[model samples]
Target: MIGTAKYLFGLSVGLIALLCFAAGAVIDRRPDVPRAPPPDAQEVRAALGFGQMALILMGTSSPVSFTLPQAWLDGVHSLVSHGKDNLAMDGRIDGRGAVFRVSKRLTRHGWLNLAFRLEETSAGGAPRLILYAGGWRAPEWLTAALLRMGLPLLGGSQELESLIPAFRAEDQTVQMTARVPRALVGGLQAVLGSGEGGGVDLELVRAIYGELLAGAVLEPEPDYARIVRRAAMQVDSAEGLKAALVALTMFTDGPRVLRLAGDRTKTPPCALTAFATRLHGRADTPKHWVLSAALTMFMDEKTGRAIGLWKELDDSLPGGSGFSFVDLAADMAGVRIGKAARDGTDIDKVIAGLRSGRPEIILPSAVLQLPEALPHHQWKRRYGPLEERRMMRQERLIGNLLDRSPLYSRLPPSRP
Candidate 1:
């Protein structure tokens, strides 16, 4: 009787293990990953043009509404996801709310899927977001409990409701309406618009290209300061000048900018191709580093994406030089310069300072004093991502240095 009991017990244990494994297998089915298509130059240009137009329209007091097609959303998703193929998103509007489905592929086999609906509910006569229909491959009670715990940790629904005033999802398109501050609208207009009208001036763009070609022949080195000065000089209006400054940032770091834009065939004539070659050489200068930061900032703004996160990840990995505050300074300086271009508050002073051919005019020499690199562990311990205190201190120091400098002071105030 004892022997028979032991055999039955062993069989029951094995059956339980088998059942657990089968359950995992059911949840972990192979994920179907979609490949991102290559970017088309025409589509990119059109999108930029439309964005610029939308900024101009938003300058008015009235609310602005725009519809984004599924293709554009897919492209944006691919871009934000870094084309990892490990994650995907699908969203649509159902009735008064919107539903978003997100899926992540597991390392070995299955996909972890979560679907949620966002519906606006009235709370004390104000609109607020209520998350509904949220679940994954978990029990209903467990999923609900997890969502309830996670929502507050992710800034609650208040943040989402504030950011998205009105949203409508459809099978093929998503329409959104937003109200932007006048200051932001004015700044965008100053940088993106032509004084004669709302949209960018074709003549100004042609002149910029013309100047680039002319500079290539006239100057042996890719002197960006000279190019920017000359481009700014051609346009009489403040808006035109600001537009030129912002546009010229693309060529400042030509190689990386081209790569980011998916333009492999065409190269700017202003020794951009040669300059790209020189960047990898031993003779590269601090100016090159500063220009690269500026290009990164410009690209970030243009695409509404953050490439710096990728840079930080790459630097933090094994065999890398780690994080560098000097790089941070350069990034801050580049962002300040971009802001100046957009504000156009001191356009004359900016133009005058650029002609001096001194990189210190933009990136202060004080930045060289900062620590070169810190390993991932040290960086995490000392200064983690989005750490408010460290960021505020750094911004204050950089702001003070830029404000004290004659060249940077000529531009608008650096508001962090």
Candidate 2:
């Protein structure tokens, strides 16, 4: 009886080791996806335009269907994955369903890959999403089991339903139809329905850049207000102004704008010093956060995300610079600028004020009074979450200051 028990124990140990070895083999580290080349001027221009147009379309109430071509998706992917190779995605639509494969590098020696298919099904007389998941690093049964246990907790299905109300899968295409604001539907159709064929008009972009540079001599260190004024003066139509705004916000980093113009080597170091300086200044707010806040003006629903991302990033930093209300003030300034541009009214009046070259016209003086930086622990102790009363009061103070300013006051009322 003792010998039999020992034999059973040894067999169990061997089986466990074998299982671990098999699992390791399945999850072994492999070479990451090759780094994609950085998007060139044209690709960047197209992607930025598409994003802006998409946001505008999403605001409308008209239902429209559009197909995204593979090339366009690739450009967007390249732009989003510019400096990283740890994550990659490939998606396709077939008669059966829409399928996507996502790969994420989890560690130095392991990668997790997921393949999922979404099919539209009629259940209880309502269209529902049916998800089918497969695995690359694990067995199919294990992957399905994990997804069954995980997706409910993650609320993945509900989110998808909310984002995509209706979609039809065909060969090499998934056509999505959603209700957008009616007024913008025609314009959206003209721009988005063109697919990859609609490349950005570089000539117009160059003209906008030329206008910006023309005023540089008078105000060598033009602030945000000056730059907007120059662009607004050059673009007479709403569409043209939108294009100009998209170009301005495309790169939060000023040097990238110089590179976009052409070879950075040929451009003098001080050529766009003021423009670049303004972007990186203001209490060390991350450039990406500034970009997010600027972009959120078009999609008002995402304003909270921009604010949250900024606070989250500030919290992650070590040392004295935790969450800075000064940085928040700068972000609010950008958001105000974006909202003014989006309103497409009082362009003449706005230009007149900006032409005065008063920085205070756009950024009120009260922003200077906000605390520069507060460590995370201290910020929590005082303000708690961002929506807490103290924080809201501080934001209200900034709003009142902006309301009292000339530039922001001219525009219609908008969300902070």
Candidate 3:
């Protein structure tokens, strides 16, 4: 009876060891694949269906596998909170790999589709987050053309930022009976809300938006229009920027692409800067993680100086609040922040690590936000103050650009 019991116990222990070995083998056998490059806009549009736009690619590495579904869901929720879309997933797992489907509205009549997948692939031998979107292709050329035509709107470039402010009509203290397309609301808001009885009155703001639109005197620039249309058709190739002029064009011309890029301004718009700063002082309202991460990255990039891209990012939140350049470029691009928790990682360190060793920091080419453009040459090669001459050029350039706005003369000077 004792001998029989011993044999049974040894058999049970062997079975357990076998199960462990199998599980370990399953976990370790991810493919040795490399990360994919940024998909060509035309190709991505084709694959995801052309009706959708905006691609977010995140990349990271970890010895332990993540709960990918949870991470993806968290990402989607974050985006939706920032008004990307109310997204749902339809997915399935096959041996060692999985795929997810995501969709959203791009316009009243148009919808966008996307596909998300997880794989053991790396870019330059590092893991990457792969996202694909479908919609009307608004390429860099189109943005540049629009800018030259005085649209003051550019999207889909990490080097440029959006200048268009978002409109929140429902938040108005005083309600107006008429309803305008949500697309047109932002321009109208910008026009109406320039400066009123006091600071940030929504009703007064709406009124200001209307007055500015009505007061503008505009003329046709055939050359600018021709360039824009051509660029829209051949977005992948257009590089040099033609001079886009400032004219109050009707927002009703076509679908208003809310994702816009700002001109090369060295500082954030003063109003935005002040608004973000005020949030820091409010005890009732906790600062957002995106804002916190951006501020942290901005400070690190500025070398502890309270200036540069971080300040601009803080101020620009009103135009498209709730999204962070760091989130889009790094975390969403797949650098697992949580994985580095034991490495004493924080937002500042993560940003510093990513920006280091690269000739230029590359940001995700999403709508509304992009990394502040770096100088073409060796950025670190400067004497005294790094990039001082370039900084002067950017400041002058932005000043001239802002001066051209119809609302510029009426708006109170942004805090210097």
What does candidate 1's lDDT look like per residue over 52-141, in tens digits? 546555545455667656555454444434423456555555445555555556455666555555554433211233332223233444
TM-score for predicted model 3 compared with the true structure: 0.20
By lDDT, the best candidate is 2
Q: Candidate 1: where is the Cα deviation over 4 Å? A: 1-198, 222-227, 255-314, 319-321, 410-416
Model 2 lDDT per residue over 87-172, tens place:
55455556645665545565676755545566655431112343322233444444444444334444343234433567665666
lDDT string, candidate 3, 37-110, tens digits = 22221222232321121121111111222222333333333222222122223443443344455443334544
RMSD, one per candidate, in order: 22.0, 21.6, 25.8
lDDT for 402 (candidate 2): 64
Of 2 and 3, the candidate ahead on lDDT is 2
Task: Please report, as a residue range, the 10-residue window in candidate 3 with the lowest summed lDDT.
Answer: 240-249
TM-score of each: 0.44, 0.45, 0.20
Cand. 2 TM to true fold: 0.45
